[model samples]
Target: MTRRRHPSLWIAMALATSSLSGCRCSEPPAEKEEPAKASPTIQRGDAVLVEPNAGDFFEARVLGLEPAAGIQSLKLQRSDGEITTADAVDVYKLPDESAAAAASKQPGLAPGRLVICEVAHQRWVGCRIKTVSEDGYQIEDFGGEEHRISLKKLMLPSELTRMNLEQRFKIGDRRRAFEREAARAGQPAPPPGFSPGFKERVIAKRGDEWFSAHIVRFHDDGAFRVRWMADDRENDVAKVEVIPEPPYQQPPKRGGFVLLKPNVQSLPWARWRVVSVRPELVLQNAAGEQSQSSRREVVPLDPDVAASDEESP
Candidate 1:
């Protein structure tokens, strides 16, 4: 039946319906959250720093990965050609570019300077600086291989000389101690040339290369401990690896002119003519004064200098 509904009641019902619909439309839809990105995994042939049992991290190349005892391990090869294994957790990948802004600056270090650098196997060898980098220095070794070395691994010639002198002094002290022990024991003096510090220079052969070096120790087993001049590195060498180097290679020739310190009391060297070389170097000055001297006491005069000396009254 079409019963007349109250106007107020109809309006209230309509408003109630509108309010419910507006409330439903007011809320925005819930959004879906994205997952966090994961880091790139380590792969083969990547340069990484690995820590071994020594607890020190060094540069190495990843050879491959292996599972040991249910834990992942990486096989790495060091710059020294040594292959080792470390847990994946101990390996860190190296960045393409160094994070440091600039390399540490040091005195006596510059591009093109010759230095001794520690490359493979912690062995120091001669290298030339190519450039500076935050990691260290870019250097080319004598073998033409390029490597980045830290500052502590680099040594200047002067610094190496200083170190060599210090090492020599230490060796000399040891020699003195040995001598004192021999004296106390009523033993005869150690054989000459068999003692340390016996020679100032020696030709030392190391790895197919002959180097000028100083004797650090002469062992009872006939082995020699020599310090190389090229890098001031000490190495134990066999007896055949070392030999005394004469003070002078070529002695003054007969009839040649030389600057000679005639005697131990002589303070300054004087120009003289070489009379004889064999037996001993006999010299005669411009005044016909004759004297005997060792090759080390004389400096050979250049041809031009000798000619000028002759031309002079």
Candidate 2:
């Protein structure tokens, strides 16, 4: 029996088959894989901002690595003066220092720029190179103490290394360049150490917080342009906001006494002599050989006390 289905039934079956085919054509396409991103390199003594989690960032200084834990492990000193530990994977260099220029394989290190070098016991200290030679680098630390640090131990700040300290100061706005020249002619000169390129700790008005920065240039009235290296920020801070951090190497007058560290491994309390002040505060004992003390470890004795120490047996 060539019994055929109704014409309507035949039409329904045809439509059903077409719909199934269309469903297959409408299937979603596979997604392509994205390329891998490169990770940033970080090392000890570099300034960085760390991210503990999503959206939270903290400013920190890299103390060093804890290889026993992992290559990614690091010791950090926070902006608030607190010392803590972190992971290298979680830390990132500042925008201006993203290239890790200081850590590069190139050969370029000059004097007068601030650099972080590994000091005694692998301690990282911020210092300026007084002299660079084939022998080694003579590092003048923040405390004004001098050290003979190896070239391999130095971590040159990318910005400061490539650019002189004077250039880093954002002197002014559009008219600042011309204004500086005009003002220099007639205005009373700023006192020494307050002039351009003087590094000091500044107190911010926003949070009344204290941070290290350097004077860029002096303004007509009393304002001074300053550069904050921690975040690569520059602005004008009032004279009042700027205060000098007394360096430990102040040379006292002849026949006068100054507080000093008794031994390389001792606390800074012993009263020492005033051989000369220029270049650096030179102190000595009955024995010869120049010794250095940290600014934090040294204190100045009042003239009255200094005189008494000198007169003492």
Candidate 3:
């Protein structure tokens, strides 16, 4: 070190020191990765759990995964005993094997078949598959009278042979037509020949006295036209006049009288004596009371003569 060193010897010593430092600074071994877990697959007869929002989980049988639109649909049994189908997003696969076995043992409708049920007094009757829908078959009671029901109200069918095609087709067509006509009318269905209540009144006048008469013609404006026989008239001819009330009104009272006056000039004779007062007409004698030869002699009371007499009086 005290003596002067060669240039090549100094360079070689520097190189050896750099190589030793590089060998000792290698990277640590990568950490071993844990194996990933696989999601369980859902199968038939599995006890599927549905989590609708944050509520308690509901247990139902796994009918099948029905592919529709962009996702799958899962048919489930409701706690209240009603069978329904819901989206897969609302359901989860259950891990309970015993629950799945119990659910599988329960009888279910065949595919394309549904339980057609007739409910009476809160009891189900006539339950069987009568028709098929795109996803399920219709179940109904073949022993009972046929009825119309919506498709969504039925449970999924497990088989198809139990379906009654004729009855289903007929009922569906009729129901659809009825619905179409009801929608087109836009008004509520009306009972046949519906009628409304109304009021009527009738009033008849004879000379100065007014008589209530029965109404024959009724109008919407609270007016009625009447037809009735004159109480005083002996003739059976019916007298008709438009009155205020119609359809129903009081009849004329008994003992009411009507008078018929003749024009003085139109009379056959000038002076007359009252004879008989029958219902037909007022009979009179055109004669003077002087003598037998003056029977036909009487005084004339024409319009002009009556007017002169009025002036003189």
What are the Cα lDDT values of the candidates?
A: 0.52, 0.46, 0.34
Q: What total of clashing residue pairs does each candidate reach?
A: 0, 0, 24
Q: Pull out the clashing pairs in model 2.
A: none
TM-scores of all predicted structures: 0.22, 0.25, 0.19
In terms of TM-score, which candidate is strongest?
A: 2
lDDT (Cα, tens digit) per residue for candidate 3, span 90-140: 444443444334433444444333342323322333244555445433454
What ordering of candidates by lDDT runs from best to worst? 1, 2, 3
- What count of clashes does model 2 give? 0
lDDT of 2 at 257: 45
Those runs of model 2 whose alpha carbons end farther than 4 Å from true positions after fitting are 1-105, 158-313
**Descending-TM-score candidate ranking:** 2, 1, 3
125-151: candidate 1 lDDT, tens digit per residue: 556788976667898754457898776
